[model samples]
Each structure stands twice: as C-alpha cells, then as structure tokens.
Target: MFGPTYVFDDPMTLGPEPSSKIISHAHGITSSASKEEDASQIVIMNLAFNDGKFNGSALSVLGDYPFFQKYKEMAIVGGSGAFRLARGIVTAIIYTYNDTTQNEIIDFHVLVLHY
Candidate 1:
C-alpha cells in the first residue's frame, strides 16, 4: 500500500502536528519461510518527501520484515533531490498493528549522509 507519511518535529510529543508529508511505496516479495504461519517477506520501500524541510527529497530502503519481529533495520542505499547519493541505515519499530484493518504505525530512526 502506498500512503501518506506524516512528519513530526518532536518525537516525545508526537503531536497531531505534522510539518510535511511523504508518499511511500512498499512492495513485498515472497520469503523462504515454508510454513504458512511462519511466512515473512522482503520489502523495498521508497519514501518521497513532499513538503517542509524534506520537500522533494526521497530515500530508498530494502529489508526483511518478519511477521513477529517488533523492530527492524533496513539499509538506505540511495536517495534523490536534497538527499542525493545518500547512504545510511534506517531503524523501524512497530508501534501498533491491526490485523483486521491491516494497518500499522511504525516509528523510524534514520542516520544518513549525503552529497
């Protein structure tokens, strides 16, 4: 699903205040887990920032998302616009998930360097 990601200025408050929006695309690929209950997927995500300080910039991520894991780390291989030639790591932790709605809230931490 491609959705709008709201950007918050402060992590502690995590208020309704959003400074910008990011369009995200995440494609899932079949994993090696044989059991149906143990299945997982490899995902690639591209996040394009649309406003505020990060407007026009984009970053790419590739990683494994285990069904039961609460925290995941992905590699940031590249980016565009203000983040051109970026490289770094992105850490994501699951905040809340809903099985019936198939919606989830994740907290992300990124450390990047660009030229």
Candidate 2:
C-alpha cells in the first residue's frame, strides 16, 4: 500500500521561506540505508516545521520516491510534551537496491518539532 503525505490533521502549503523545522535520522545517522524488501522498497524523508501560526509539519514517503504531496504521510513520533510536526518540500528521491553481501537495509529521517 502507498503511504500518505504530510500526515497530520492540519493543512499545509509549499511556499517561500517555508516553515523551518528540526530533522533527525532514526538511526542517528545522516546517511541512507542500502536494503530492499521483497523487491519492495521503502524510503522516508523527514522534514520539520516550527514557527508562526504553524505548530509543525511532518512528511514521509514509502514504497517509492519522487513522492508527491498525495503520497506523503504526516509523522507523529511523540505526543504532548513531545508533540511535534514536520514541514518541508522534498525534491529528493527514495531508492532501494540489494548489495553483494545481501543485507536488508532501511533508511529514513525523523523531523523533530519544537516551539
């Protein structure tokens, strides 16, 4: 199944200055994973937005890359004290392929929101 774009109950826009956010990798690494699942691929990009009237924004792309707004999902990591959102226009792509050693690798980013 395809993933949702900008996973949140709030609305979003791709405009100038763009809402700023804090992004982090789940593995704490700024690198990419080199594993593919059953010929199926999963790629995620984490964008954070925090400022103005906006609480925050989160975007996730799975299965494929060059994801459109309709294919992204709003990521909610923690709640309340950790409540946050992700925001950002991703012009990047998600790619997955097997290596010679054959390892199931996965890569994604986590956008941390803050006021």
Candidate 3:
C-alpha cells in the first residue's frame, strides 16, 4: 500500500509554474524485476490543485531506462474531475537519488488536454 505524501517546495524558485504546493498520492504496479530494470510499469496518481483550481487523477504507463538516465516520460490515457477526458504527456526527472536509503526525489511535468 502506498501512503499519503506531500510535496512542499517554493515554485517561485522552481522555474516551471507559479504554484506553491502540490499534494498528491500515487500507487504503482510493477511487472518488472525492479524499478531500476529496463522494463515498463503502471502508476495511478491523484493530484490536488491546492490553488483551488481543480483536482484530477491519472493512469500512466511508464517506460524503461538506465540508471544513469535521470529523465523518463509517460503517457496519461485518461482522468477525471478537472481532468475529465484528459489525455496528456508527463515527464519525470530525477533530482536526488539516495542509494543507501533507496529513495529518490523526482520532478514531474504534466501537459494535458481536456474538455
């Protein structure tokens, strides 16, 4: 089971968006041997637009990669709520990796089209 997580950052310094916070939850299903393996994985995530704009969820199919590669991209097939009928592309970049703790800090960029 995946627990709730909070992302706290200063978006003014982040350079991408003007939002201050992004609260989200995600659960992943891995068919590959390991996350570091060059195989595909599935992830379901719910993102909260804390600015009171809207909230949405996404189902993404992620691609494989080498450990040295810090970036990855996924396809969002569909979503709900503010993202109803949403389809988009999502990009993820590894910001920090802790080999000892097997933890990593990643940055995600999402571009969506919806009605």
**What RMSD, rounded to one decimal, does every model reach?**
7.3, 12.0, 6.6
**Residue 110 lDDT, candidate 3, scale 0-100:** 80
Candidate 1 has its poorest 10 consecutive residues by lDDT at 8-17
Residue 89 in candidate 2, Cα distance off native in Å = 15
- Over 4 Å off in model 1, which ranges? 1-38
Against the true structure, candidate 3 reaches a TM-score of 0.60
Worst 10 residues of 3 by lDDT: 4-13
Clashing pairs in 1: none
TM-score against native, each model: 0.68, 0.23, 0.60
Q: How accurate is candidate 2 locally (lDDT)?
A: 0.32
Task: List pairs with backbone clashes in candidate 3.
Answer: none
Model 2, 88: alpha-carbon shift in Å? Answer: 16
TM-score, predicted candidate 1 vs. hidden true structure? 0.68
